[model samples]
Target: MIALVDMNSYFASIEQLDRPEWRGRPLGVTNGRTGTCIITASYEARACGIRTGMRVREARALAPDFIQVPARPYRYAQVSSSIMAALESITPDIEIFSVDEAFLDLTACQKLYRCPVEVVARKIKHCVFEASGLLCSVGVSGDKTTAKWAAKQQKPNGLTIVEPWRVAERLAPVPVTELCGISTGIGRFLAQHGVYLCGDMKQIPISVLAGRFGNLGRRIWLMAQGLDPEPLHREVKAPKTIGHGKVMPPDTRDRQEVDRYLMHMCEKVATRLRRHQLQAGVFSIGLNTRRGWVARKLKTVHPTADSDPLIALARFFLENWWDGVGVHQVHVAALDPHPQACQGELFAPDHARRDRVLAVMDAVNQRYGEFALCRAPLVKRSDMPNVIAPSWKPAGYRNTLEP
Candidate 1:
């Protein structure tokens, strides 16, 4: 059997757990203190029609007393690590789906537990709560897709199980959009083809689905049948790209201020590359402006994981591409990473010294906290938005810097 564990209103729930006063109150967690968008809303806030992605003004309009809490990525990471450790005790066959979700292959461990799958699900909930004092919903079924679907059937603290025989019956009335990979666009397309529900998908031929969605259509058909051939990825996949981006404060475009933020982002990307002991052969920078996105990419002479070169490249890209338009966002990305094995500059002693300095800085920051030892320019800058990427994990390269 496969099981999925999903945290409910993850960021908001963590906020409430850490702050007793915030419990039982309508609250929304924002990306930063000044962030306009709601990252997540507590059940109380949701009850008042507040939701993730709603602007702070909209949330306030819905609930005048709605409390806004800035996200603490470090705190969330710590809690997630503890919860994942608890899960590891259950079975080694597990996939860390995201910072807030995971999938476990329970088939092999069933004999060890010697209990009903439902009992095991309850134990998982109890273990997670004991580890982090947070509630999570669990779904168990014969496959991963069905289990994920079942997990969402209940909210807050819930455990739902779909026996093999009941998969079709239970999923028959559920909308196609409720499945993991089916977005609203795909759902609408399916609806047009009279495949609105899992059961309704039975009418469409696999060939037609394949023709429309390519490989994904066959996967959708299997998901509707509650059969997922996809196996749990016990191994962590190497990240294809390391990047960071930040939204510029509304209507603010001082060149010096933008450069400071850009430098900060490049430093972050470089830190991540070094943390993973990787080097990027390609660099890219982008700006989202009122005129739309302007981006450029450069292939470096050699792979590097150093911040100075990255910052320089970013500035070069911006200088060449940006037309001094009203900027809304800045992005920095390091691509085509390979294991760090760069041959140092033979004649450039300054490059060697700089590398040593960066190593020391990294060590100090890792021991203390993120940005505890940062570039001089970032000293007075306000905190970056505490938005966690959807690809965030409890461990490995994707385990981002804490704030």
Candidate 2:
């Protein structure tokens, strides 16, 4: 069976965990600036109509007793690590979806845990809470879709178990738009017809769903019937491509700033390529333009992740295609090595040292922290947000790749 585990009031719970005085009270983690929206709110505050992404003023007006707190992005990741480590100790079949959610395949673990899903979930919750001082709700089911939806059946430390027989009735009441990938555009189009919910959509012929949604409609129809083929987790394979992009504030472009961003993205993308014991033979630099996106790629003399070669390649593209012009955004993509198929070719003495340097840096970052020994340029730059520009450092933090 698969189980979806979700943390309760993640950001706000961290506050209560660190400061006991906030317990059982209406609390929220608002933006650093006052008058901004509350990014997260506690379960107690939720009862009084407070919720994440709601204005702090509105939340405070809703419940005057609510205490405000600032969001600590790192602390949430730390607590996530503490929880994921506990889960790994229990079972290795974990598919982490976000900081506070994971899908676990407990089939193999059941024999040793010596209980059904309910008991195992309870024990898991207990372990997580003890480790991180936060509560989690769990939903156990036979398939991935049902497991995910069942987890959302009730929340904030709620528990729901759905055996195969219960899946149909349990899911019939939920809306079709609730599926993970349905966009606002698709939902609106579906709503224009009589398809208000998944059950309603199912009553229509499958042919019609397929005709309308292409392949996605067929997948959605199967999901509604709890017949999704996605595994609880997929094994990591050799890297296909390495790339990074940024969501800068709407309309601002300074070439110097773009250069810094390009360097930073290259550092990260190249690091990931090398981390999997592979390298790239070709590099692509992309820029979003006033009217279109421009991408230029070329095969290199050798596979590489070193910053100097990557920077030179990027500069070449910038000089040719980019005139320090109306580029709205920057992206760097490197293509090579489906890791399973890649074999390292013996090269110069530098190849061995470059690999060793990456290893030593990885170990150091693991012990100290990210950007602890960063590229001198990243460290020197005061214009870019420090956390936004991470290096070619593979993060073992929280079991999720940090952005």
Candidate 3:
């Protein structure tokens, strides 16, 4: 059996956890200030017709008395870590599905636990609430896909059981979009063909589905029948690629300033690769100039995470591809990075020394804050871009990896 643990109203719940009076009110956590979109809305706010991505001012016009709070990534991370730590006592075969959801494989423990899986699920929710002052839903099933759907069926501390025998009946009313690999576009296509729900799609011919969506159609057909051959990989997922990008202000024409931003992005990507114990061989640098979006990619000697190597590669890209529309945006991406790509040289020249210096710099920056210190070149105040999103905050990495 597998258990999918999904936190309820994750970002808004953190706000309610700290402020007791905000409970049972129409509440929202937003991206920037009042007029921006609501990144996360509490159930009370959802009930009042507020939703994610709705503009805050418009949401208020729709539902006037909505309470609001700023989204705090660190607070959400702290609570997530507490919940994950508590769940470690039960099992370690946890596959993180998202920032607020995880799948726990329990196939080996069925005989050990005398109580039912639903009962155990309830106990897990209770422990999480008691420990972190938060609420979550648990779904127990024969597989990860079904378990996730079952959990979402009832939320805010809901628990649902989905035995192998009950898969079809339980999933009958679910829309095709709720299935594992079926996207909103695919669901719309299926609806056009008179198949609106999972039950309706279950009767569709595999040949027909395959003809429509290619390989994805076959996967969707199997899911309609309560089947998925995909295995849950508990190991840290190797990043398919590492890249950083930022939108630029309109009508910008500073060449040296754009180069500095590219360097900063390269350093951030290199630092992330080192933390993951990986290295990259490919360089992908892109620029969105005033005329249009222009991109340039290049490859270098072996997989590496050292910032200097990437910086050199980026500089090469700029020299070759830069048309000088005064470039608006810049990005540095590491591609095809392999595990155990750590090949730092001991007797090597200033490269090795610079690598060590960067490591110490990372430690200091992490301890004090992201802007503790910097090199003289990129020290200007205009270099730091103020970004706001659903996350990407200081405290986003506090979670245990669910083993």
Candidate 4:
């Protein structure tokens, strides 16, 4: 059996757990920047029609008393680590899906417990709560897709199971969009074809789905039949790209201000690359303006994971591509990474010294806090982006939230 454990209202729940008085009150967690949108909303806030992606103003209009809390990525990371450790005690064949979710393969360990999978699911819930003092929902099925679908059927603290034989009947009423891989676009397409529900999808031929969605269509068909063949990904793969972006405060178009934001983003991306002991062979920068997105990608003669070079490249992009329009957002990314060991410049004494300085800076920041020792431009800045990526995990390179 495959089981998925998903935390409820992750960021908001963590805030409420830390501040006991906030329990059962409407709360929303923001990205901790001016003009930031809601990242997560508590069940109480959801009851008041507040939701993720709603701006603070909209949330306030819905519930004036709705408490707003800034997200603490480090705190969330700590709790997630503890919860993941608790899960590791259950089975080693586990996939850390995200900071707040995981999948466990119980095919081998189920007999060890000498109990049904449902009992094991309950044990998981108890263990997670004991580890982090939070509630999570669990879904157990024969495959990862069905397990994820079953998990979301209920919220807050829910447990749902679907046996292999009952997958079709149990999922009949579930909408196609409720499945993990199906987006609203795909749901609409399926709906247009008269396949609105999981059961309805069965009426469609696999050949037609494949013709429309290509390879993804066959996978969708399997998901609808509750016979998804995708296996649990227990191994952590290296990220293809490392990047950071921020939504600028309203009317943020000044050159100096945009430079500061761009510098900060480059530094963040460089830090991540160095954390993974990799260097970017390509750099990409993007800006969202009144017209639309303006972006540039350039290949570097040599791979680098230094903030100065990244910042320089970003400035080049801004100087050449950006029109004098009001900027809405900015993004920086490092791509085509190669291991740091591949860089020949490490043999140069000057490059060696520079690398040492950057390593020390990274160590100090990791030990103390993010930006404890930052570049001069970021010295007085209070708006460092703190939004945690959805792919954050408790270990490996994806553990970017670690302080």
Go through the candidates in order and give each one's C-alpha lDDT: 0.85, 0.72, 0.73, 0.86
The prediction achieving the highest lDDT against the true structure is: 4
Overall local distance difference test of candidate 3: 0.73
For candidate 3, lDDT tens digit of each residue in 258-288? 7777777887777777766777788788888
The C-alpha stretches of model 1 lying farther than 4 A from their native spots are: 342-350, 401-403
Model 3 residue runs over 4 Å out of place are 32-35, 63-68, 210-215, 250-257, 288-292, 300-304, 312-330, 339-349, 376-403
lDDT of 4 at 49: 99
lDDT for each residue of candidate 1 in 1-403, tens digit (9 for 90 to 100): 9999999999899988888998999999887787778888999999999988999999999999999898887788788889998998888888989889999998999999998888899999998999999999999999999999999888879899999888989899988888999999889889888998899988989888899998888889889988767889877689888888887776557888878878988888889898889988798888888878888888665678888878888778868877677887888888787787656556534467777898999999999977899889999665765556677787787788522
- CA shift of 351, model 1, Å: 2.7
Give the clashing residue pairs of candidate 2, or none.
238-339
How many Å off is the CA of 358 in candidate 3?
A: 1.5
Q: After superposition, how far is residue 280 of candidate 3 from its true place, in Å?
A: 3.2
Best by TM-score: 1
Residue 58 in candidate 3 has what lDDT? 76
TM-score of each: 0.95, 0.77, 0.83, 0.94
Candidate 2: Cα lDDT at 369? 67
Which segments of candidate 4 are over 4 A away from where they belong?
33-36, 342-349, 382-384, 401-403
Q: Give the TM-score (vs. native) of candidate 2.
A: 0.77
